[model samples]
Target: MKEVLVLGAGYAGLKAVRNLQKEVGDNAHITLVDMNDYHYEATELHEVAAGSVDKNKITYPIKDVLNNKVKFIQDEVVKVDADKKTVELKNSGQLRYDYCVLALGFVSETFGIKGALDNALQMTDIDQAVAIHEHIVETMKKYRETQDKEYLNIVVCGAGFTGIELAGALVDERPKYAKLAGVDESEISITIVEAATKLLPMFSENLANYGVSLVKSLGVKIMTGCMIKEIQDGRVMYATQDNEELQAVPGKTIIWTTGVSGSPVMGESGFKERRGRVIVNDNLLDPDHDDLYIIGDVSALMDKATDRPYPTTAQIATRMGAYVGHAIAQRLKGEVPEPFSYNSLGTVASVGNTHAFGLVGKKEYKGFPASFVKKMIMNKSLADIGGAKELFAKGRFDLYH
Candidate 1:
């Protein structure tokens, strides 16, 4: 029987295993290795951080999702030898593989902004989200005793999807935290700083404008064309639109969601990279090796329509995994694989309970209806990955106002 080893049980890796099981059947031995036993919903991390949803809701056990079809190994991958077709585990012995899939996802890019990495919190996973939630709760408690205005300020150091989403969530949770800590809602402040000239620079200008307006209406300050010079304890230094350097803005908490880079393992493996992404062929396989496949955030699939790489999202990663799974199964049967192509349906971003922005199939949606669509998308992902019962258990169908 052929062996398939998938590293990093994330969106892409899990999807790959699912499709591979369906195609290859009981003959092939499929193994999934991951550092964590649970698979986290990366998209809902901002909501988890804001306390809008429980952390457990955004994560599902890999064993539960995979059942017995694929063997689950809860171990970190220490090294990969593509040439030798072997993977060295942190504790477990090295395992050889007939084929390997690298879907290690991405790490937060601090861009070397001084204290940004050491001081600022990130929204990468469920644990990070929980940490942000706990930090906010603790900060609120400290503010009640000292009444330090800095404790009420939160600076989100990016205007991208993660930064914008977190800013909106923080704004929504401000009143809840204020009530819980016996403080006034007016005392809390949220600010977003973006190095780009406009928020959501990837989106259409009209949509970007609408998103900025919706967030601004939620009492979040959106500062565009601002470059962060320094991030120190209790302050953030930046350059203003006027090209003049500015002093640090006092804030107790700073969240860095500026950028993302591919995993170090890719470069360590001697794969050709551009901006930390492996340069793969159209089939999402490495040009240097035939047995190696890359997908998700670590793989750069070019968008022929735009002449650039596709944006890294869960939707794209899931779709890529399906492709890789099917292709690998074909290869196992001594057949050729098809090239990978992306068909973007659209995107949606939530602002608060009843506000969202969406661009779906050339149609624009906003306000309450868009929020409804966004919630449905979230629920659908849960259902697709786990099941209806898992979605219910995760409390993702909650329509709490």
Candidate 2:
């Protein structure tokens, strides 16, 4: 039997393992490795960070979705030697494989900014998301003792999709923070700072404006065209076009949601990469190594239309995973698989639990209707990867609320 190794248990790697088990049958021995044993919904991390949802609501055991045909290992990956078809694990030592899938997920990108890494709270994983919520609660308690206004301030750096969603979630949970601080909800302030003047470029101008307006209506202050210079322990320094002098936003809870890059293991593995992503071929294979397939955030597939790699998203990652699984099965059958292609069905940004905006195909949705569709989309993804068990247990069925 051929030995197959898949890294990371995110949307990409997990989906790949599920599909590979069914497609390849007894033809291959599949080994799946990840640092964590449970798979959490990456999209709902903001909710966790904002304390709007429990971490358990969005995570499920990895073994719950796996069959006996696939072996699962909970260990961190150290590096991948594609030329030798070997992977070095932190504790499990080296493992050789006939075929390997590199679907390692992303990490928060600090952009080499001073104090960004050491200062700001990140929402990349379960622990980090929970930590953000804990910090917010602690800050509220601190405000009660110290009576410092800075403790009531929350500053989010970035207006990108993740940043915007997080801001919305924070707004939804403002009342909780207010209660903790023994202050009115309005006393708690939430601010979002972005370098770009224009926000939500992914949506149509009208839709983006509607989304922004919805967030602003919640009393969140958004400062655009503010380039973040550095992150201090309790402040964020930025410079705006109107005034080149650095201005500081004082906040006890500073969130770093600027952006994310693929796993650093890509670079440690000696792959020719940019920003932790490998430029894979049409077949999603390393250009020089046929046995190696790189998918998810770690793989960059250029879009001929845009002359740039498609933006990394859970939607694209799942597609890449499913494709790789089927492609490998076909290869085992002595058949060549077709090149990968993508067509996005839609993109949605939720202002909160009850508000959202996005385009489905050529039609745009906003307000409560958009929120409903967003939940459905999330449920669909849960079913696709985790099946009926997870869908019923951890699914977002709160449509009317």
Candidate 3:
């Protein structure tokens, strides 16, 4: 029997394995490897980091998502052996495979900013988000007891999707946190500092202004064209267009959500890449390796119409997984796999629990209407993975104004 190995239990990895299992049942042996026992919803991580959502609500047991036809292995992939067609695992030794799928996710790229790696908190994973929430709780308690404004100051270091969402969620959550800690809500401050000329540069400037307006109304301070120089000792130092020298923004907590790079696996596999991402061909296949395929954050696939790569999101990752799975299945049957094409139904960004903005089918929506659509999209995502039952179980059904 041909052995198939897929690394990472992310949207791409999980979906690929599931689709492959369904198509090539009893004909191939499929095994999925992930370091985590549970698969967490990465899109909802900012809410968890902001202490507004429980981590349990965003995660599901890995076993719960897979079937008996596929074997699951929990271990960190140490290295790739391309010549031998084997993967080096930290605990499980080497795993040999006929076909390999490298869906190994992303790493938070700090851009080599001084003190960032050592001082700033990044909430990309479940553990990181929960840690941020716990830290915020402790800080709020200290602020209540000592009446120290420093303890309650939160400086989020970006204005992109993750940074802006955390900023808005903190706006809504700080009051509750203050109540829990017996402190005045006015004592808390959440600021978003960005180096860009304006927020959400990828989208329309009007949309960015809309997001800024909403967050500003919630008491968030937006610092545009200000570049963060360093994060250290409970203070973030930044520089402005006029003042080149760094100025400090006082805060006990600094959360960095600036950027991400392809996983370390990219360098190990010796794939040709730009900006640490593999530029895959039309089929999302690694042209250099017939036995290997790339997907999700690790890939840089350009849209023919725009000539720009699609943004790495859960939506794109899940689609990439499905495409690769179907491609592999077709190849198994000695047929040509279809070339991958991205179809974006819409994109949405939540400002807080009660408000959001998105472009759906050429129609723009904001406020409760957009928020409602966002929740529906999430619910539909859960249903796609584990059916309607999973939707009811993990879906976000609450509305807080």
Candidate 4:
């Protein structure tokens, strides 16, 4: 039997393993390695940070999810030597592979702003969410003791989906938190800062406006076209729209959601990059190598129709994984593999517990109907990856409340 090694147990990696097992039948051995032993729903991370959902709801044990079909190894991949077809692990020693799949995902992009890395909290993983939750609790405790309004201020660094969602969730939950901490609701402040001219730049103009209106109605401040220059210990320096001059805003909590770039593994692996992402061929395989393939956020797939890279979303990554899995199985059977093509179904973002905005096909939706659809999409994704039992155990079915 041939040995196939997969790196990262994210959406792409797990999907690839499933497809490979089905396509290759009993002739191949699949091994998956990841730094952490759990798979997390990266999209719902903001909800976890805002205390809307438990952190465990977004995470699942890798072994419990994959079972016997795929062998799960909990270890960090330190380096990959493509020339030798070997991967060096942090603890399990080196492993040689007949074929390799890279699905390492992405890392947070700091954009080199001063005090950004040190002062701002980021929503990246389950651990980060837990940290944010604890920080919020502590901040609230201090606010009650000191009666300082700045302690209640939260300045989000972006107006994109993640930033907007976090801001909206914070606004909805802030009142409850203030009551719990014995603070007045008027003391709480939540602001969203966007460097772009408008919010949700990827969504349609009407949908973006709707999202802004919904968030503002919930008392979240939306500051567009504001470029952040610095983030001091308890303040942020940014340029407002009226003038290009920089101004300072005091806030105890700063959340950075500007954007994300390709995983650091791509740079370490000696791959040529454009904006921290590796350039891959049409088949989602590295152009310079035949036996190695890249998927998820690490590889850039161009859309011939638009002359730009496909958006980095779970939908696209899952499709890429399935394609790569089948392609690899064909190669192992001494047959040619087809090239990879992406069909973007749509995009969706949640504003609050009962509000959302989505673009499916040519239709645009908003409010409760859109929120219901978005929740369904999230539940379906969980069910697809880990089945009904896992979804239920992870509280994915609790979207009704």
Candidate 5:
């Protein structure tokens, strides 16, 4: 029997494992590995960071999700030996494999900006979320003691999905937190710093304005056409529009949601990569190695229609998982699998607990209705992972809230 090794238990890795088990259970020994034993819903990480949702609600045990036929290993991946067909684990040493699927996920990209990595707090994983929450709470506590307004200013760097979500949650929660901490609500402020001309620049101008209006209504100040140059102690320096004049945006609590890159394991493994992502062929396999398949943020595949690289999202990873699983099964049967074709469903960006904007096909959705769509997509994601049980346990079913 062939040893099929899968690395990284994020949405992509987990989904691929489940599907691969279904296809190759009788033909292969499947071993799934992840750095963490628990699988967390990454899209909702901002909610966790802002103290809006418990991290437990979003994370589920990996064992509970995978079948008994698949072996699960909780360990860090040190490197991949492509020539030898082995995966190097940090603690458990090496494991040989006939076929290997890598979905190692992503890390924050500071673009080598000064003080961004050292100073700005990121919302990447559960631990980072908890850290951000503690930092915000401690900042609030400092405000209570020192009565310094600087402690009350929460600066969210970048106006991307994570940035907007973090800013909106702070806007929704900070007032209540201030009130509970015996500080005036007016003393707390949430500001979103975007380098773009507007928030969600990918959306249509009208829809983007709608999102902007919604956030502005929450008293969140948005500095558009702004580019941050450096982050200083309790201050962020930036330029407005397309100018050279630098301005300092101050806040002790700085949440960086700028961007993300592929896992470092790609480079360590000697895969031909750019920005931590391996360029894959049409079959989603490395050009030089057919036994190796790369997926999720670690694999950068270009879209044929848009001529741009597809955004790294959980939905795409799930689809890729199913494809790889089927591909491996076909290979085992001595048949070639079809090339990867991506059909985008839509995008739903949440702006606080009760507000959102979304696009499905050519139709646009906004406001509370869009929030409903967002929840539906999240629930569907849970079902895709482990069906009804996963949905009931970790799904976001509170649609009306």
Candidate 6:
């Protein structure tokens, strides 16, 4: 039987395994490896960080969705020797594969900024998200004891989609923090520090402005056009264009949401990559090796229309997974699958649970209506990953709230 080794049980890898197993059946044996036994929704991590939703609400066990044809191994992937067709795991020794899928996911990118990785909290996974919440809670306790206002201040060091959503979620949780600190909600400040003057480039200026305004109206402070210089302990140092002198904002909770790069395994495995992302060919195969297929955040597939790579998102990752699954199955049957293609459905950004904005099929949605659509989109993604069982279990049914 063909030994198909799939690395990482993320959206892309898990989806590909499910599709391939269903098609290949007993013809091939699939081995799935991941460090964690459970899969969490990467998109909704902001909610987890803000304590708006429990981590369990967005995570489910990997074994819950695996079938009999696939063997699931919970372990960290160390390296992949593409030339030798072998993968090294932290605890499981080494494994050989006839075909390999690299869907290792992303990591926090510090962009070589000094003190960023050391001082700022990054929300890349479940543990980090929970850490942010715990840090905030502990900061509140410190505020109650010392009555330090900085303990109640939150400085988000990015205004991108993740940073904006996180600021909004923090706003939603401010009341709880206020109660913990024995202060009014207004005393707990949430600030977004953005380097770029223009924010939310994903949507039209009007719509993006609307989203920003909504977050700001909720008492979140947004300081755009301020380039971050460095992250210091309990402070964010930045320099604005108007004044090159370094200015500082003191806060107990400092979050780094500037950006992310693909898993380090790509570079360690000798794959040609930029910022841990490999630019895959039309077939989503590594330019140097046909046996190796890359997807999700690790693979950068160019959009011929815009002459730029498609932004790595859950939507595109799922599409990549489904495509690879079907393609591999066809190859196993001695047939060729068509080249991969993609057309995005739309993009949505949620500010807190009740406010959202986005474009779907060229239709602009905002306010509570957009929020409903956003939740539906999230539910749809969960359904695609885990089907009816997980969708009902961890799905977002609080659409009306």
Weakest ten-residue segment in model 3 by summed lDDT = 380-389
List runs of model 2 lying over 4 Å from the truth: none
lDDT of 2 at 18: 84
Identify the superior model by lDDT, candidate 2 or candidate 6: 2
Q: Order the candidates by lDDT, highest first.
A: 2, 6, 5, 3, 1, 4
User: Which ranges in model 1 have alpha carbons more than 4 Å from their true place?
Assistant: 244-246
lDDT of 2 by residue, 1-401 (tens): 89999998899999998899889967889999999999989999999999989999999999999999999999999999998899999998999999899999999999999999999998899999999999999999999999999999999999999998999899889989999999999999999999999998888899889988988999989999999999999999999888999899999999999999999999998999999999999999999999999999999999999899999989999999999999988898899999999998889888889988899999999999999999998998899889899999988888754
lDDT at position 192, candidate 3: 86
Error of 3 at 321 (Å): 0.5
Total clashes in model 2, counting residue pairs 3 or more apart in sequence or in different chains: 0
- RMSD per model, one decimal: 1.5, 0.8, 1.5, 1.6, 1.4, 0.9
Put down candidate 5 lDDT per residue, 276-310, tens digits, no spaces.
99878888998899899999889988898878778
lDDT of 4: 0.83
- Give Cα-based local distance difference scores for all models: 0.84, 0.93, 0.84, 0.83, 0.86, 0.92
Local lDDT at 202 for model 5 = 71
In candidate 4, the residue pairs with backbone N, CA or C atoms under 3 Å apart (3 or more residues apart, or in different chains) clash, namely: none
Error of 3 at 157 (Å): 0.2
Better of 4 and 6 by TM-score: 6
Q: Judged by lDDT, which candidate is best? A: 2
Clashing pairs in 1: none
lDDT of 6: 0.92
Error of 6 at 378 (Å): 0.9
Q: Taking the tens digit of each residue's C-alpha lDDT, what string does model 1 give over 1-401?
A: 88899998788988888788788866679999999999888888898888988888788888877756688888988778889999988888898999999998888888777888788897787888899889888888888889887888888988888888888888888998887567788778899888888567667889889999989988898877789888888788888768675767678888888878877777776678865698678989888888889999999988889888888998888888889889989998889987888888789998866688988778888887888888888887777666677678874445556
